[model samples]
Target: MLIHGVALMALAVAALLAAFSSIQKAGWLAAASVAPVLAVAGVLAAWAAAIHLTGGEKFDDHPWV
Candidate 1:
């Protein structure tokens, strides 16, 4: 999970840089495409980190069983 988070964060950073470069060279259309990609990467990284910190137990755990 830690590794996954790290990888996702790295991807997010790369996407962000690409977005910045695209905006500078092209226009809003290029940057807009990158925005969602970066956002998803960032969210995935956060979710992975949270799952790792929570000891792999999700909210759906069958504790009553």
Candidate 2:
């Protein structure tokens, strides 16, 4: 779970950078690629929030300590 969250964050960062790059060098179609990236980021963020709100331990049923 820990690794999953970190990986998601990394993906989001990569997506953001790609989106910025596309916008700088391409046009509307390239910019459209960013929508999926943003969606992934949103989903990951929501997942993280759900885990936090439900008590972090619930993520994979393991206690921090």
Candidate 3:
């Protein structure tokens, strides 16, 4: 899960750079190809992760500890 979240963030950063490049060199349509959906997903992922990490601690079940 940790790796997956990091990978997703990397992908989001790459997509954002690509979109900005396309918008500078090409047009809006090209810029819209990947970033919009990925951006939305990235925001949702961050929100969920924030909730999970912060709100989750209160409900944690530590069997091993």
Candidate 4:
């Protein structure tokens, strides 16, 4: 989960940069295309972090434990 979260966050950051560049260069269509990816990845990353952090204690049995 942690790894997944990290990966997703990285993707979100990249998408955000791309979206910004698209907007700055007057490429609204490209920006619009990447918007959903940005939103979904950003939200899922947050959710993964929250689940991992709150799922159990330090000694609990889990994949990342």
User: Who is ahead in TM-score, 2 or 4?
Assistant: 2
Candidate 2 global Cα RMSD:
7.0
**lDDT on C-alpha atoms for all candidate structures:** 0.65, 0.64, 0.61, 0.62
Compose the digit string of candidate 1's lDDT tens values, residues 1-65: 66765665576567667656777787877668766676666566666666665566656768787
As for candidate 4, its clashing pairs are none
lDDT, candidate 4, 1-65, per-residue tens:
56765665576567666556656675667567666666666566656556565642365478876
lDDT of 3 by residue, 16-41 (tens): 56656667777777767665775666
* TM-score of every prediction relative to native: 0.52, 0.47, 0.47, 0.46
Please report the candidate that would top lDDT against the real structure.
1
Clashing pairs in 1: none
Please write out the lDDT profile of model 2 over residues 1-65, one tens digit for every residue: 66666665566566666666766777768678775676567567656755655546534555765
Q: Can you list the residue pairs that collide in candidate 2?
A: none
Higher-lDDT candidate among 1 and 4?
Answer: 1
Which candidate achieves the best TM-score against the true structure?
1
User: Lowest summed-lDDT stretch of 10 residues in model 4?
Assistant: 51-60
Q: Candidate 3 — which pairs collide?
A: none
Clash number for each model: 0, 0, 0, 0
Better of 1 and 4 by TM-score: 1
Better of 2 and 3 by lDDT: 2
